[model samples]
Target chain A: MEKEICISELKRLSHLYDIEITVAKKAGRRWSYIVNAGEEKFLPSQIVDQFEGYALFVEGKDFDNEAVVNAFRKIIKKINAQKGG
Target chain B: MITESSWIKKVIKEEEYKKYMNGEKDFINDDEIMQKIEKNKNPDPSKIRNIMKKSLEIQTLSPDETASLLNVTNPLLWEEIYETAAKIKKKVYDNRVVTFAPLYCSNYCVNNCLYCGFRRDNKEEVRRRLTLEEVKRETGVLAGKIGHKRLIVVYGEHPLSDAKYIANTIQAIYSVKAKTKNGYGSIRRVNINAAPMSIEDLSMLKEIGIGTYQVFQETYHHETYKKVHPSGTLKSNYQWRLYSMHRAFEAGVDDVAIGALFGLYDWKFEVMGLLYHAIELEKRFGVGPHTVSFPRLTPAKNAPYVQKTKYKVSDENFKKLIAVIRLSIPYTGLIVTAREPARVRNEVLPMCTQTDASTRIGVGAYSLWGKEKEQKLNRQQFLIGDDRELDTVVRELSEMGYITSFCTAGYRCGRTGKNIMELLKSGKEGSFCKLNAILTFREWLDDFASEETKRAGEKIIKREMEEVKKSATRAYSPQVVEELENYYKRIKNGERDLYF
Candidate 1:
């Protein structure tokens, strides 16, 4: 069964990672995910691509929570590494 | 002149003040400060050193700790304090001194400040405000010809230089993309040093993407503030000025700067007052000022108080106080402006994060340069002690092994306000700033550097690049390093305004 990823799910995942996620209309009904960590930003698709083979998907209807959390953890690790932590 | 009551009613938004104030209004505890200073007469050297260690960790010192630093008299201990101050600055901000030029938009002041040349009643002073076109022209010279990436635009406390006018002028300055030698140039950041405004008015500035909004409590001593500002004026309300940052934060201004004009009250008390202000802001807003400025009062044409102040800071005491400030608020940037002479500026550069070069305080002075060789005191607020050109100052800094950075990336990249404060305290900001500094230094060197300065600057850039390669590799991802390298190459190839 294909599950549609709503704004609420994405927002919940953002909260879990302590990141800010904003979904805005791109063209008609298409929504873009804007992920913000402090002053840095990453498109949801970009992070999914960075950690390939994670089963994380930004364009699919049913979003996998485990896959989403794994991708977010990778993003947090990269940012923390940049800050020398 | 307009009636005082009418002007006060128009400018002072009482409702805004009441919203932010406590019932008792216990903002500054003057008696408590005096008692603390009196009690911490002789601090143990070992305890003071421990406090210095804490400052090195980028922690804000308590008022008591700062008072002890102010009272230190032993010459050897002072030397250690100065060394630690430099170390702390390097750890947080790196060996880069950010440079900016001051653009005085208008000298038509409403307040009759005792020590200001632009005071309304000064008959000898000529007042003028820059039109939008004139601001564009001045910015052309600063960004295109002089090569400054940031500006601290100063305005007087008058209706003519209100929030609307400031926003229009800021847009004008940003619109200028003047032609440089090999690339285009523009003022990347515009920080305001203007009169405090109501939360509503400050919101207007926030919408325009203003940089740090700075308001100085000229004298933190309430009695001195009253005497200097006079009664029946908007500035006479000390609490309004004290809580200006609170209003700024409410208006969504990310970064706010605070300062005190030295020589007004006891310098020691003034330093303590600044610490208290920082502490109060942190307590109320969860962040302190992004930067702090302490410009010593210099003589003005018709300002008699400038020459006769009993609390005038001596040269030795001035250096000591600046070092103390660096130690007291290790996370906040300390600005030592061109108000001091070149020699004094040279001595204090290591202990400070930013300074102004090629500074002309007179309104429209840059455009009037060829026509007017000397600075007319009647046209400016005060006499600038260091009027050296930008290239000369840059060369001198390079000779001292410090790179003069023109980077304004952090503000644009969302590394400002609370984000920047956290990075600055954790010592992570310097790593990012170092990369940007190298890229911007390359841009400036290719665009505006003189032959001798370019030679000196190249050496510093090479050294900085090596440091970045070594330190940044361990921290940043490989992608960031690749992006930095690409930008470095582009800037070397005459690209301008490149940042990490």
Candidate 2:
């Protein structure tokens, strides 16, 4: 089976990174995929649920200056955003 | 006349050269070998031949030379040694160490290793060999832990936990091709580290896509080996153990790892024997050890040697041996295990992993977690030298300017077997570079690497392209470089997916 970093992991990444942003992505995406909160080309798929192929990031200086934690926030916010949508 | 001729014991002169050439030999530390080599400014082959009647090159390196090679502080020498490793890495791998885990399918054994808790005679311990389903479950669990790209099924030698059971387990490991099967599609390889097998059993594993066949001699000295291994599979024929690599080679398993458990014999003699073994294998077959391991004896549940000081390896000395081994056999991969503490393992391991770009990994190391003691982790076989987490190791490698890689050119290409060695010996460096280039890119594109790791990999790629450019300067194709650039962009943007 394709074991992904589960969608629930975004919350964990969010909590760990200490940031607030909304995140959503295509479902079934490998959750270990770290989204650099800095890049523009990396974006969420238009199809909300099938978004396993894409992700959203909370743009901020945090993403660039400290990407490790920033990636966590982006991933969590993206996951949470998708759930809300 | 007999008594007069019997003056021969004195005439024998106890020559150091005699032992190495043909019989049971009197080996020396590096100090002695170098002393002899430097004694005469003018190395008169004829004169030395008149005194010793031996070829100058008829020898493996002495213990001190082995040690000196390990003490190799120069990056220039490291590059010289690692160049061959890099070339071989380019051929068999790229910048990758194919990760796997040891599924402790059975703890049963019939041998008394004197140093192992799982040895057969340890009646005080609860002995358990997992059933087929249990084995499957463990494999199922392990498949998820390391992301299932490969697995190394480990078991102690016992009658019940025999070849048939092992073969079945291999199938079960492979059968769980889906993550929902509580298995993973990630586990593409399974290497076995069990007892010496029959031709038939070895054949089964060969058919099973087992990546490599590995066995440690523990100690190459027969007397010491028997003394330590009083009552197990190891107690049998020492020759069988020595010749096992030959057997695996014959069975069509190209990748094999051989190691000596240090502190068992005079470390110097053991190193000489190891060199002999490696040289013999390469001379016998075009390919030698896919990897070599140096597992210093450490504490275990039933281990009795913790207090034994006679043969223990000093950290500085062991590191020396490791360095020399890297320099001596440039093409072969060297492995350092968690048997030592994190400090030692951390210091020595990078030499094999990054600077050397070694193909070695922890024997049953499930992840970078083996570097540290984590509650969720398995009870490792021995005390680990470094207990850093996997991500930490990746970060450290990157921080240290080494690439944390996931390249696996071996899987994508058919370089396994006589085919690979032939290409290597013939100096088909381009084919090798091509293979590693493909794998390094694939890894960067998929694995959850950090930015620093990502950057190191990028630098390595650029440096390697420049290397390829330098060698084939005018003749180099622009297409390969262009393709690499696109992959780099995709990786940077996180546009590619695993196996995409």
Best by DockQ: 1
B283-363 per-residue lDDT for model 1 (tens digits): 887788999999999999778789889999988999998999999989999999989999999998899999999899999
Query: What lDDT is reached at residue B263 by model 2?
Result: 85
TM-score of each: 0.87, 0.62
Q: Provide the lowest-lDDT 10-residue window in model 1 chain B.
A: B472-481
Off by over 4 Å in 2: A1-85, B1-100, B131-148, B178-185, B231-234, B353-380, B423-476, B483-500
Model 1 lDDT, full chain set: 0.80
Indicate which candidate wins on TM-score: 1
Model 2's CAPRI class? incorrect
In the order shown, the chain A TM-scores of the predictions are 0.31, 0.28
DockQ (0 to 1) for model 1: 0.06
Q: After superposition, how far is residue B231 of candidate 2 from its true place, in Å?
A: 4.9
Q: Give each prediction's DockQ, rounded to 2 decimals.
A: 0.06, 0.01
User: For candidate 1, what is the TM-score?
Assistant: 0.87
Chain B, per-candidate TM-score: 0.97, 0.71
Question: What C-alpha RMSD separates each model from the true structure?
Answer: 7.5, 19.1
Shift in Å, residue B414, candidate 2: 2.3
Error of 2 at B398 (Å): 1.3
